[model samples]
Target: MPHRIAAIQKLTATEPHPERVAMFAIAGDSASGKTTLTKGLVEAIGTHRISSFCTDDYHRYDRKERKNLPFTPLNPECNYLEIMEQHLQLLILGQPILKPKYHHADGTLGRPELFIPSEIVIVEGLFPLWSKLSRATFDVTAYLDPPETVRRAWKIARDTTKRGYTTEQVLSDLEQREPESEKYIRPQRAHADLVISFAPVEGRSSLSATILLRPTVPQPDLHDILTPATRDAAHIKLIRDQDGKPVDALHIHGHAPEAASRLVEEKLWEKIGLGGDIPASLGRISSTERSAPLAIAQLIILHHMIHC
Candidate 1:
């Protein structure tokens, strides 16, 4: 077992599953920026310290077989939920699992890959938080809910460019998956400790992210971190969430001057150093260039994972 998981077990000895591994669940719809966000966290924490998995791998049928099925892949019936739950339990107990691999490129099932438990196991996919049993396995949960228009654009770009789908085919597939997404996907948002939404700001072409820090988990003190950054320039705020409950709503401007984001980064690093040093490859998005707001978001998640 990884040292961090062992240390956590020693620290939480009295709790159930005292030897449980630290796990994070990132749930979202198709192309909802799950992989983009997960990549940053892995980089910040050091890839060697984290073992990642996707619940989509539990799909019972290959892509071609799914074409004849009545239910979509998003439906629970289409996945090996029982096996996933069993494997998750094993992972929490510091055991290894012979995991199945689904090749996205050719729509074929590859050989089972043996994955041993690590200090942190990141589970990201369409249904990581879909069940109560699966939900209990995570130490932290996040849901990505980008605007529909923005998500569609992202999905089209990804599917056409990487997944070998034409633009029209991708759009048609999305239309067919809408009902499943609404039924089995979006509802997972309520179970998240954080709901992240990235979209273009009004009157500005640059994209910005609004992170809703829910009360379900402990959050960093951005107020203390933003100390001298002045409210006018720094967009961070602690306000009521949509449910009328008090929550910290952090807004990171995409095109904001470097000094503005740097101020926040400095304070964040001051409070919690980036695993000793800032990672050189952190915060990369879909494009080659990195976004300051995305980097800050990654830092926020890394801080919580270490300090929570």
Candidate 2:
């Protein structure tokens, strides 16, 4: 994240604010591995550095409660959005926030968690970046664009295995989640600083993460920035627009042209301005690294958590 040029004017408040706490967000479609990514970011930086929550926790009604209704979690009307916004504001101001816990398996709200002051906050979920107020809370924001086929497959497996849904039950839930997705989830990509999507080509176990790094921030170089996690999975390339502007895209797997991959990596690493051997710790767990979709999510969240 670039240094904040915008300044906050002093305003009346009951509690004194802490050093302006930076907030970052991850937004994506259902079953698109948002949780997986968020989990990793929390892991990379100890949870203490980041107090995180999923927007799914703010659903206005539990799944069972909403089953009778025509809409599901995808619709903004179905979430306690104003409350979520208030919570973010509190967290940003170095204040305490008592947050509700959602029991996804049972579709119920659990006890409230005592969230004390934190310096960095990571919020993840569908439409996490949708609303202007919510978007304003983040110093860095991401939009995940995994293919629907991959997302659906991941969702089906996850719901059946973890949430105890039968195959058919999972399918039905997916169907119910779709209408809201089309209406609300897919339209918020334009506001993000980065848009990441994975495209897996045939015969390759690997996949490429198509990253659109918007030119709105001071772009970091990927070279010195290249940890083992990124270097091993894919090569980077730069894609130039007709007007001679360049957009960086990573070729993680499948069908990314060699020329493009070469283009992106050079520019990305160049931005980082680092020299000497790369960090050996980064790819240490390469063999055990999570799925590309999940890894991509982690990388995105990690970017915001640290940069923001």
Candidate 3:
């Protein structure tokens, strides 16, 4: 009996622990499509297996309070970075935390709530990858790099419609935050494993997506999926990164034929080995509108979430 008990303990020790969790960080400047991308991922992966929140909730000041401060919220000084780091560490260990909340609509801080970590955790916002300590908590990280014009337009639309900001106020705030954005926000892109950009394809209202895959982490092998026959829908090529390093850039044409894009999506879904139809929510831009490029991007990220 004693020998059998010892053998059981040894076997259990080698088995995968149920409490192991994977954390992902999606960091970008304001209105750079961070939340939208995160939303699609959460939906695709199922919220039961995912817990997501915005790091913006750690803001040290409300909008009214920031009026007296020299720096905008984009500055690290305006957020509770230390506390955020602590919470991230806790979540990585499958622990729960009482997280603070900041309401964007009224620019007010709300009561803290208990947040339990799931199998996967996605933290998105301005400073998820701000420091080495914070970046170390995530298994994977992605940064949104939409063009300035596109991001500006998105900010104006979202702020005016949802955040109670006028176009003039939004524009002025963007101008004021530019310096901080340049200093604090853009620099985080260098630390991300994937850099994603969505821009308008000429003559097409939809936006094309370009994803730069860095070798910091292992990415899916797309050679078999993106072939000459499907080149119009998506393709990959070697490109020089900002630091002059060679990286693989995957481009998904927003204007490609639906069938062609769907074939690529199907192949990617097969690689995930989830064994079901793709989630109806994969590329949703709105309740009624969907973008193929957005869907493809989300699938690629989903693959990393499960396999990384």
Candidate 4:
């Protein structure tokens, strides 16, 4: 029993922080919308004020080497997790570090880049919350828990177009990586203060989002953001989570009418207490398309990073 307790403490040991920088973690499996969710927050907070990096950069093996290794990149053994923990501690204390760069376009490691800590730092990748010590570095943590069907579709599209993989190759790789994802990635959700899930709306082709706001962390009161009727009718809801715990489940319908989405956006901006100069382009994932749900989700996260 004493030996087991020592092992647990070693896994969760954290250094006392001297400075508090707002750190946020976005953890999810491959093609789980981790980057998509983070893009909007980067824009909303302004890139100059935010220091963001992908934790996958800590990968111990490049693409070629990973193929020969028994364990996939999702496993902690395949990553420099101890180094990552050290860097996270340094960043929280307002210190800079030399960060390794991984070039995804060609599956190669680039030269290390100097990273200076900013007012806010956002770290996103598969294993940001894999260890308790690393998870302790973040002021806020979110896990993307999209439905598997949706996630598979996103993976196929993203890998084929961006990563130069064929549909068949991506599918096969996903199959091989599933066990690792279940073992390391999904378990991190329990450490998150928020879980963002995007699923296809029934009878609709577009995807909507449901954000699970855990009571473990302080959340902005979106319920009273608008008037009584508007608040009640708004897309957000306060419901009990699956475990019979009271949680706020913010639903942003993809097929919502223009007027309704606009109303919600305006109310969110009001809740932000920011001036009218807030740009509409903050949440756009692509050049031509924008998701109100994505924007609102970014707003909710930004509120925590900025105010808290």
The TM-score that candidate 3 achieves is 0.94
lDDT of 3: 0.94
lDDT of 2 by residue, 1-308 (tens): 23332222323443454766878777898777667656655655566766678888888888678878888788989888888888887887777888877787877877888877567777888767778898887888878888888888888988887777898987888887887787799877777777777657767665556677767664444654344444544556788633466777655654434444343343333333334422222212244653443344345445545554
Q: Which stretches of candidate 4 lie over 4 Å from their true place?
A: 1-20, 226-233, 236-244
Any idea what lDDT model 4 has? 0.82
Which pairs of residues clash in candidate 1, taking residues 3 or more apart in a chain or in different chains? Answer: none
- lDDT against the true structure, each candidate: 0.81, 0.67, 0.94, 0.82
RMSD (Cα, Å) for all candidates, in order, is 5.7, 7.2, 5.4, 5.9
lDDT of 2 at 117: 55
Off by over 4 Å in 2: 1-17, 223-246, 254-304
Ranking by lDDT: 3, 4, 1, 2
Clash totals for all candidate models: 0, 17, 0, 0
TM-score for predicted model 4 compared with the true structure: 0.89
> Best candidate per TM-score, number?
3
TM-score of each: 0.89, 0.77, 0.94, 0.89
lDDT of 4 at 126: 87
Please identify which of the two predictions, 3 or 4, would achieve the higher lDDT against the true structure. 3
Extract clashing residue pairs from model 3. none
**Candidate 2 lowest-lDDT run of ten:** 276-285
**Residue range 258-284, candidate 1, lDDT tens digits:** 777777776776677544666645567
lDDT of 2: 0.67
